[model samples]
Target: MTRGDSTELAAALRQWRERLTPADVGLPAGPRRRTPGLRREEVARLAGVSVDYVVRLEQDRGPHPSSSVLGALARALRLSAAETGHLFDLAGVAVPGPGRVNDVVRPSVLRLLDRMQDLPAMLVDARTDLLAWNALADALLGDISAVPRERRNLLRMRFGPGGDEHHGPVDEHGDRGRLDRSSVAGARAALARYPDDAALRGLVDELLRSSESFAALWAERPVEDRRVDRKAYDVAGIGRITLDCDALEVPDDDQTLIVYSAAPGSPDAEKLDLLRVVGLQKV
Candidate 1:
């Protein structure tokens, strides 16, 4: 980036940092604060960077950071997807393309997840990486948060080794071929969107190399959004329960928010309420 761009980026980072408070990020505000919002140390901690690095970034004196670091910063600052894209531009880096997947959740999306207290809701990017999920989602989807961030992709879990280990409601569907087709199509769509994304390319390559099923399906070139009407689960305590599944699109970020709900006042609804309590405890 040019010197002017670097200066502007530093200014923007400082502005975002100063405008947010500890409470905004779910942190405790300590005693005897000097400046407003979260401290630079707190930002560094949240972004998983050193305090010195954060200072250099704010001062426009450090070397340019990688896209991953920028993504972490964007999430720590609670930036919208648009704002995150702008931050990357100023930092002399291109925003994540279709292939370059990042799991930075938008603040508005997080708010939406918060509002769905009863049903299970999860947010994923075009790459199908699980970004943010509510407690109920964790319960119904087998606690994606339990996995390492990189391994949280749905395509990976569905086809890779130990795939059937996740004892979630979706596992009860029994239609493996349909699920595989949908996954391949989703991955293809992401590839089409970001042909130049190395990480995305790597994921595709890895899947193709590892799974004969994935390779054969990819060769067929099937394309469609996989939305199913009803999903059944055999919970130990709840026995058999079914719910309607909907995949909503957040067009701004090219992300999908999956929501699972049952009919009101039905037996499934009562069981879902019981599972909500179960899910909250697991989270």
Candidate 2:
């Protein structure tokens, strides 16, 4: 299986290529962005790697990757699906496929979410799919129960404009410009793994068809999740709110557990309480 290193690198190349974006995710495309996708140099900078190393890997140069390098690549490129698996495979780690929910939250982790009533908390599967969420957090996003099961994805919502008009809880702020820019970065990062994924491909097509900004960024394919990134939102009647979005790594699963909270009992906290009242009143 060690010889499969070339295959891994080859997969990574395709994944990386599909996930890159220039100027969208802070990668300067210069005058050569006509083709869309990564420019090789951006991958190097984001992954903390040498340009030559990226070239070698992209070309299937038979280089075995170290764990640290793989982790760095995963973070830098916002790799999803096959891309993450390929990274692990290059490093001789086993990878799971789509819809593979091997993650089971420990009691201690669940307890942590329950105790932090001041915030919105939920667990997302490895593919960045929301698996479970507290009621307060659920209100932040639409009725989690009401959202279509398949469309419960963050990157897809933003990148795949046809998928959903709004980002889950992420767009509570009214800064459409900021949301547009950041969503492109996130989509580029998240799609690095499954370049050929039908679902992902569909979303990309939708984005390209809808927003001009999305079309430009989609072409660049920048990758990197930077999961803990912060965003502001202006939900209808909710006023302005800020939430700290972070990914908590869990064992045995690629799912990310998330928590959202306002600054120490801020007005946003009361707003969340209001959300509960309004959300339940309709039921």
Candidate 3:
């Protein structure tokens, strides 16, 4: 970046930092704080960077940050997708294009998740990386929060070794083969759309290396995207319940919101109500 560009970037960073409060990002608002927003140390900790680097960047003395560093800072600052692209531009890094998967969840989508309190819902990226889920989803599926961020992928959990060890409801439909094929097909379709995405390519490579079944299905060159399906889960202490799984598309971001619900007044619906109570108790 040019000197003038660096100056503007520095000023923008400072302004962004100062506009946010500790509560905005789940940090405690400590007493007797002189700063109007998050402290430099807090930002460094959140972004996994050194305090000195944040200082130098704010002062317009730091070198242009790499794309990964800029991404981390964007997430740390809770920047909107547009703001993230602007930050990349300021750093002279190419913003993720149509060839890449957009993993950033929009704020409005998150609110939609919040509003869907009666059913199990989750948001996943184009590659089926688990992004966010409501409490009902957490209770129905295994406690996904316990999984490491890098390992919290739907296909990885289904196909990776020891991935099924999580204690919770198990798929009782006896349709693993079909599910596996469809998942692989979806991944293949995502790969076709985002041929330049390193993470998607890496995931496909890892699965091919690790799973014989995945490799066999992938060899068939299946390329279908996920839509609506039926899933049956055997919840512990609640018996078996079957639910309709619907995939809602967010085409702009290449994301899907999956919602699990049962027919009204059906036995499964009653089971879901019980599960909601169970979920609240755990929380």
Q: Tens digits of per-residue lDDT for model 1 on 19-105?
A: 998767645577978998789997876666788999998998978888877887887788987898889889888776544565667
| TM accuracy, model 2 | 0.51
The whole-model lDDT of each prediction reads 0.77, 0.59, 0.79
* Candidate 3 lDDT trough over 10 residues, lowest sum: 163-172
* CA error at residue 277 for candidate 3, angstroms: 1.3
Q: Rank the candidates by TM-score, best first.
A: 3, 1, 2
RMSD (Å) of each candidate, 1 decimal: 4.9, 18.0, 5.1
lDDT of 3: 0.79
Off by over 4 Å in 1: 1-65, 81-92, 97-105, 167-173, 233-240
What is the per-residue lDDT of model 3 for residues 1-283, given as tens digits with 9 covering 90 to 100? Answer: 5623788789888988998887665455778889788898877765667889999999999977976577657766777888877888788888776788886667677668767889999888987887667778877875665565567688888788876554323344656667777888899888988999998999999999998988999999986655888888777667778889999998688899999999999999999999988855663
Candidate 2, 195-280: lDDT as tens digits = 65555566667667876777886677655456575666555557556766776777655557777766656776677676657744
Q: Which scores higher on lDDT, 2 or 3? A: 3
Best by lDDT: 3
On TM-score, the leading prediction is 3
Order candidates by lDDT, high to low: 3, 1, 2
RMSD of 1: 4.9
- TM-scores across all candidates? 0.71, 0.51, 0.73
